[model samples]
Target: MRFYIQQFIRTIMMAVFAVFFLRLHVTGELARYVNPKYDGMSQLAAVIFVFLTFIQFSRIWKSKKDNQAHCSKECSHHHGDDHSFLKKVISYVILIFPLLTGFSLPPQTLNSSLAENKGTLLSEGQSLDIVQESDDHQYFPAVENTDKNHNEKPLPNNNYLQEEAYQKKMKTLEDVHSIDMNEDIFSSYYEVIRASPRDFVGKNITLQGFIYREEGLHSNQLVISRFLITHCIADASVIGLLTEFEQASSYEKDTWMEIEGTLDVTTHNGAELPIIKAKRGRVIKEPSNPYIYPVLRKMTD
Candidate 1:
């Protein structure tokens, strides 16, 4: 009887990877890690790992005749059998550590701390290229808001919108006197308003997000922010509107809220941007999916 111990360990590692990825999808935790649009890719990875695990399993058991033939001096082939003991231990530990962490620790939502770390409040036009593309760009002719949330085709909540559909969403938004920043178009629409704050002056608006505050914000002002995840949580960046209300200071950072207000011009570090002059607000529980992903595709890419 003969057994390839290294092959057995490799098989187990491959199986672990397959199961770990499957667990994330089965438990609905995958969305917390990546955009739903790429779920097919991750599921594919899991399938490949499963296939590799089976292939490695076949290598773990061989008859004495096969083992002897395989290990003969004339047939010498490196398959990790010559790895130094210390090298093997260190390499396995390095890999197993992250897998252990993934299983033992729950995934976390991106918080305002990440926003503060990036040194971007998303209020400035210059830093937005990191998380959002130009939505309205400088100046697009506006369309009348005949009906809010009405479109020739309803915008899919997926990661990309067709060019025509995207333009329609932005065009309708610009001409509207009031807006509700829904999750479907949050990131794209936000960049447009940030790009052309003057066009949206005095327009009533409603939005919801966790509270974010920084040093220079007035006592009446605090940011209502959401982390915008482009590819995955690792690439998340904070985006939101500056909001001012009489009782803004009563809410602590990271408190979830929904607020109604009107858009008005504000200067941040000498650049003009939109700020919500909050008329009324109510505290709300945090959303299950708190991240805002970019909605439109960059057809240019």
Candidate 2:
């Protein structure tokens, strides 16, 4: 009977987990914890949970006869053992805590608090080139072509010229720098700015993020950051741009805001870093899906 009861408890826990994912899916909140590319995996887990639940029910049905056969006072006394009762209580408590907390509290994306603890990337301007190397290769692959005949020497591919033209056009747009930050293009914009901060200097841009103030920052200096999650929240890291706003002290830590500004280079602790000179700022609600996902392909829109 105790074994069947334990199985039933486990079944309930599995169902709870299954429902948790379902809840996130239905409310479009799954993107907060994971990239949208992995949404199918969550659905698959829910299906597996349902299958396991059926197996648990089958086991419970089969155990009914054995439970009746061992229904004597001796078995009852063993089932009521203090140590066994304590173990069962512990097991249930452990299983129920996550489910209760998940349902009771609202789901939130990583914010300034987590950014402060994990450390922000805006200060690490020197490492931007290294971070962007792989991304550059991925986005701009080499163009190659071979001559069809032995008499003909290999000629440069016209595709290379076209790609060069495209890059030049992109650079011209970057120079204009009127950037609009949204879920689709956030990663791409971040990569560009980090890779070559000087190219974007004096360009007007508007973006939104939570406030993150690192140690030793001046009264006018604060970071506007968003968590970049590759897989899930466990591996989330903060990436942000520094802002120079005189009224920074008026906003509380972790407050969400939309900032419009011009990108410029500034020296902080002898390190040349990119900072936004704020022209306008306004408080805004946090986005439902706050984490910026890495772009796997070129963002055309």
Candidate 3:
């Protein structure tokens, strides 16, 4: 029974170490080992770690025989202080090396191999980029309402707001527009979280950000984007909300619009989807400096 309990404890510890190592590998925390830019010494450390994990597991099967050979019976030396201390030192070195290398990562220092697959980080200096890209981007172009009569006009609705868990702070049209027109969203590390089913699933939420169009979808449908900044603008990502108005056909792509709506769940192609059917939506003149939101892949990553 005592032997079984000891084996169980050892197995648990090994599992913990394995899980920790695997997570660091999967979430890209282990990029330094695979990076060509790392110095030779860094690469050597990685190879040593891989070798150590294998050797430690190898010792388990021969533990009794090894102990007997290393400690003579007449000497009565069990695997005593010196051996125990060495084991501890080896464990510490093995565990600490991987994490230490991970901590040395610089801002956006990830490999270029994965960079194209990742989202672009934006800053306040790139506000013009938002204007140009968003204005030029076409999600559903043919349906864009170019008719002067159909252009969006602002509607005042003091009672239109439906309370939510996450609320968008009411900023005056002037206050929102005046947020440093010269600065870009990337420089500000600004992010917009929306109250749409796509993000929060079923939760009611409010959103504040500039509108962007998706080409394959209906022409009037727009995606409201907000930057999700992690450490800096260079690492920013964009999050989106899908908005559809009953009179959606009346609006153009890239129109600056404010919308208050309920969360709606729907599907697109084969996957689940979210739709915000506006309770009230009105267009405002494109703000002098618009807030561009970043895209974060997963919240905890």
TM-score of each: 0.83, 0.70, 0.31
Best candidate according to TM-score: 1
The residue-by-residue lDDT of candidate 3 on 1-301, one tens digit each, is: 0133333434544545555555544554333223212224444554555555565544445445555665555875444345576786687678557545544653232222232245332111212211112222222223322445334442311122233311323232112422221112222222322222344333333454556554354644566554343433455455555666546666654555555665555545543445565555556554322333222222231
- Among these predictions, the greatest lDDT belongs to 1
The per-prediction CA RMSD against the true structure, in angstroms, equals 8.7, 14.3, 18.0
157, model 2: CA deviation in Å?
36
Model 2 has how many clashing residue pairs?
A: 0
**Local distance difference test values of all predictions, in order:** 0.77, 0.68, 0.42
TM value for model 1: 0.83
lDDT of 2 by residue, 53-87 (tens): 77776665445566567677556454423566688
Query: Would you give me the overall lDDT of model 2?
Result: 0.68
The order by descending TM-score is 1, 2, 3
Candidate 2, which segments miss by more than 4 Å at Cα? 1-3, 63-94, 124-175, 298-301
Write out the backbone clash pairs for model 1: none
Give the candidate order by descending lDDT: 1, 2, 3
How high is the lDDT of residue 251 in model 3?
A: 62
Q: Which stretches of model 3 miss by more than 4 angstroms? A: 1-205, 285-301
